[model samples]
Target: MHEWALVEGVIATAARFAEENGITEVTEVVVVVGELQQVEHEVLEFAFENLKTPLFKNARFVLESQPARFKCRNCGNEWGFTSEGMTEDVSEAIHFVPEMAHVYIKCSECGSPDFEVAEGRGVWLATIKGVKGDE
Candidate 1:
């Protein structure tokens, strides 16, 4: 699954950051996942569990899932949608290719197809708690 790739990227980035900063004891890695990105938490955790190395052996991987939000281009209206709102076909499309979300998401107030994502669009590294050698 793509979650494997996602976890790999996260580990790579965190490792690079730790090395650059001389961090020796990484206690936690907090990741914020966007709903629109459709990141499966179980898969992401499984990937981390399988791939983490000694540098992060003691680090806890924390995933914070967030809702997808959109703003209308026409009326400045913002809204969010759940998969239940979609037709079976639309849901299937989004499940396989999340990019298709735009085809189904519409502004609730203005019914505009044109809109921008206000939040919950992608994966982000939120916090890394670690020790940088001595105080």
Candidate 2:
């Protein structure tokens, strides 16, 4: 799925940055995922595990998820995603979509589907903590 590509890309980018900074021992990595992005944190971590070697095995991957939010196009009302936001819980609900079902983000105030993402809509590697010393 696209998640694999996405995760790979993230890791590659981070690895490059780490290398450039001469980060030999990464202690922690934090990633943020917006609800609308629909990325499975576990899957992302699993991918990270595959890439982890003796050096990075001790690295910690922390996932921070933000609730999906939307602003009503008509009433200017904003709302957060709730359990009601998902129509079904797939094996990996964060990454799976029903074949015939379309995901809708309806405005809580106007009961309209016209809305813009107000929050929980993107993926970002927030930080990478490492130490640099005598080389």
Candidate 3:
């Protein structure tokens, strides 16, 4: 799954950063996952669990949700994503299947796909604070 690769990349990045900073222990990790990216929370958590010991056994995965932001194609007004608000209207689209629950966000104003994906398109690390001990 792409999520695995993404998660592993994040872990590796964090590990490399910690290593470069001469930090041996990672206390906590906070990350923000955008909704438009459509990452599975359970799988992300499981991936984190499997790699917990390899990096820092006590390191924790903190997943924060970044709501989907839709821009208005007509009036340029933007709105946050909601299940019944934006996704339900596109149920007929194959990408918005009920089983997989995947549906691209459409502009609420002009109903156009010309708008940009601003908020919900990336996984960001919020913070990684810890003490670097000398080995």
Candidate 4:
């Protein structure tokens, strides 16, 4: 899965930076993930467990999931795509094809499917916390 690649990149980048900065122990790797990415948290954790032994044996991965947001192309209305109240069937359907969001989720202002994603699209390495070799 792409999460593996993402985790690997995050670890490699952070590890390089940590070594350059004299960090001996990477304590945590915080990833900011948008819902549109559909990154599985457990899978990310698994990847981290498998991929971190080299430079970050004691490191822990943390994911901060952000909500999806959209802006109506017609009416310029912006709103969060709340999935907490969605039915299981609908959730599964959308989970299968997230692009169907524009088809199923309409603009609240003008009831239009034409819209743009205001947020929730990619993953970012928010921070890498570590301790120095002396500390």
* Most lDDT-accurate candidate: 1
TM-score preference between candidates 1 and 3, better one: 1
Q: What TM-score goes with each of the models?
A: 0.84, 0.73, 0.74, 0.73
Name the regions of candidate 1 deviating beyond 4 angstroms: 85-98
- Cα lDDT for residue 107, model 3? 67
Shift in Å, residue 40, candidate 1: 1.9
How much lDDT does each candidate structure score?
0.82, 0.67, 0.67, 0.81
Listed per candidate, the RMSD to the true structure in angstroms reads 2.4, 3.9, 4.9, 3.8
Q: For model 3, how does the per-residue alpha-carbon lDDT over 1-135 read when each residue is reduced to its tens digit?
A: 256776787788788888899888888888887775566789888988876655567887888888767665556877765556544445334222322322355566766656655566567888886558775
lDDT of 2 by residue, 53-103 (tens): 544657898888888767878899977765554556542344444111114
Regions of model 4 farther than 4 Å from truth: 82-114
Most TM-score-accurate candidate: 1
TM-score of 3: 0.74
Question: Candidate 1's residue-wise lDDT over 1-135, tens digit each?
Answer: 168888898899999999999998788999997787676788888899999978888899999988888888899988885877668777767655666777887778977788988887778889898988775
lDDT of 4 by residue, 1-135 (tens): 267888898888898889899998888889998786667899889988988855688887899998889998898999987777777766656655567677677898899989998888567889989899888
- Give the true-structure RMSD of model 2: 3.9
lDDT of 3 at 49: 83
By the lDDT metric, which is better: model 2 or model 3? Answer: 2
